[model samples]
Target: MSIKGLAAKIFAKRIRKRIDTWANNPIKTQQKVFKDLLHTARDTAFGKDHCFKDIKNHKDFVKQVPIRDYEQLRPYVDRVVDGEPDILWPGKPLYFAKTSGTTSGVKYIPLTKASMPTHIKAARNAILCYIAESGKTAFVDGKMIFLQGSPELIEKNGVHVGRLSGIVAHYVPKYLQKNRMPSFETNSIDDWEKKVDAIVEETVDEDMTIISGIPPWVQMYFEKLQHKTGKQIGKLFKNFELFIYGGVNFEPYRVTFEKLIGRKVAGIELYPASEGFFAFQDKQNEKGMLLQLDSGMFYEFVKADTFFDEHPKRLTISDVEVGVNYVMLISSNAGLWAYNIGDTVQFTNTDPYRVVVSGRIKHFISAFGEHVIGKEVEQALKEGAEATGAMIKEFTVAPQINPEASELPYHEWFIEFQEEPLHIENLALQIDNSLRKQNSYYDDLIVGHILRTLKITTVPANGFNEYMKSVGKLGGQNKLPRLSNDRKIADVLTAMTTT
Candidate 1:
């Protein structure tokens, strides 16, 4: 091993021990975080508004602060944007991570000095955990590329504002400066395809060992590189050993990615959002990411089934159970209190509090009370692809509430396949059966003759890419929704379909 690799191994050992201490005592670690966040923000405007001083425990907190999404919290966020001090956190924010919102247009999530380091540290620790567990540090000595948004920032109320990935680019550690690929100039290119082309040109011959990004964007980068070099990614970068991804499930893309790279490489899944760095896959053999209890965020969980009720019970870490779907809430040092980030997660392992993201609370199909979720669709597609040796590029599902004349309505699946299955009809049946097994409500609807088995609509090659590009969200942390109740996305896909 090189000097850097040896140093990384030693450093990783220390990080592993530190992580273990908190992971082993999750409840205590979270309680400490809860107390710290309350104490630190007690003097802020939000704290005063919410009667934070009188709040002593989790139950008191739930009573004091109601869960609010971005639109509901925009009043305080607007004040902060207008240069108000201590409106959310203490004083001014270090940065405002700008992200596109569904109904609220653009949202600026605050990043305080106290909360910013948690994001950086959590990302670093994820890699360290992998290094320590796998006893593999050689990747630390080679080139690493994180395909992300531009690093350019604009001033907003004296605070730097940009996409979270772009904002993070400013904090790349001094050690990795030499090994991180894709020059800042190249990264700054606004057009994604052009930026990716520039990245391909720069790193096609580099010793790339780690590539990190959302799966779809990274897939685009891989496709571009393959087109340019006429070689599989594994052959082009023989040293590439790891892929780090977040924002979307990676299972459905696994077969397609393996085919593109011509080999299987280790992967690390991260559960990060604009709100906070929540979790990361720690062990190669584990099924879920380790929840970060000691971070500057206190977490709460409400059963997803009851999340829409007038008063849903919020449970703390000690109260959560394995295998239950829960909507996650947070009260963090960044000034977000009882904030619903819209993610639904299931506890896979309670010993260390490991969780797998189940779906988005808002992104699901309950048009006919079937209530199918993102995880079910992704898993079903993954199983179908595996059974038929099909390589799938991307897919989405929407309810077909209205159909032509005498036919029963069914779920419509829009799929872009990298390699077509020999039996297309069999693939659809298998996927439908898999979904039926996972979601009993959907199965009951099928049995009651309220709905028919799902039908597949094959999308032309690069169809999903074109759709994203047309919507002006072709890259930079944008994820295609796996399930939608409305026909907004489905209508667009249908029009693009020739058949």
Candidate 2:
């Protein structure tokens, strides 16, 4: 057998063994095992630190550890850059994963050598689960294409500066590496134009079997591919089998992708962040399954309903109820304890821990399944406004579903700009078109020219900044609220519209 095939077999066996253990264990036993793993991780990262020493005796070690967001961890990142061991963990961190944060700022999340295995194992389990679900042995032997960022590691003074994607690519098995497409390692953050060009050039003549990445980037790649090849992507790469995606929701972009590819590519959802690969889509054509890295981190779930109300109930993995939404809390080997990542998800099943992402607990508009979150809407606005040569000073989106039968509800875009409005209607159309192109659901909903129209209202040049200052949130860390669930913001937009 080929080395890749052999490796796959071994990986699959290990995954099956783990799954069997999870399936056979009693609930009490499973809980104990999970707790033990968390304890071990805690000891490994902060055993000697004064802050963690008392954790053993503390009633709420998880709670006392302090729930941290990306901004809270930036200082530790500075420490890593200085070549000092991270305060969060006992030893030196292995790499930093760079990702865009809520404020449109860059965040470098630390990952340690001890924590890396959890990511690798979880990713493998995700693949194995796909195999098991398909019930197919000897599936097509073809190269899998991971549409990842540039593989080049940032460096200082000739030493390797590891990024998460770089570390994964660096440590990947030699056999797999041999068959993989050449990564765009010439730059740190990919030069979008050049990277797209390279991807098109490389794959134009090759038989790409699997494709994976964020939906927007993937769509961009295929669009570029079509432009170069003079044929649709589905026709060029006939051998393609799997379409794995993560870092963003695929539902809005699904119809466009399927239509472009001309077939329903087996989709897998991956839950990976800078810190780690937390979970992935387990079964073929199924929603994501939270593969508990019992050997690496401790997991907790806060019931969604209780989160916003007074007195929230925190549930362990064993306590999770199927079909209920929960905000995930994780204590990982990288030394984050009881960290609330802000993403909310629901348990689809519990036997193997399958889940579907409901939405972000914070920073979102969910009047419908649009699932339009702050980051996404922000990007859409940026792209749309920039395309029209209009620089946006600030903007907010709120669902304005009219209560009256004769009235129509649409997204009221309260926009502030430095430039005079050239054409408000044209700008609004451009924003709507950008959103529709990016999100298929938005396209479908807008097709009949019914439900949720985009209404643009120009505000004073410094309106958003003024609003931010008013809220005591004016700074590098603060961002304009893109999506608001409450009607208060909508009321303000209405007031702005009238005035």
Best by lDDT: 1
> Against the hidden reference, what TM-scores do the models get?
0.99, 0.70
Residue-by-residue lDDT tens digits, candidate 1, 1-499: 9998999999999999999999998888998999888888888999999888898988898889999999999999999999999988899999999999778999999999998999999999999999999999989989999988889999987999999999999999999999998899999999998999999999999999999999989999999999988999999999999999999999988987988899989999998888999999999998999998988999999999999999999999899999999999998878898899989999999998899999999999998999999889999998999899888999999999989998898999999998999998999999999999999999999999999999999999999989999998998888888888999999999999965
Over the full model, what C-alpha lDDT does candidate 1 score relative to the true structure? Answer: 0.92
Q: Provide the lowest-lDDT 10-residue window in model 2.
A: 471-480
Superposition error at 334 for model 2 (Å): 0.8
Candidate 1 wrong stretches, greater than 4 Å: none
Give per-residue lDDT, candidate 1, residue 67: 94
Model 2, residue 27: displacement in angstroms?
4.9
Q: After superposition, how far is residue 178 of candidate 2 from its true place, in Å?
A: 2.4
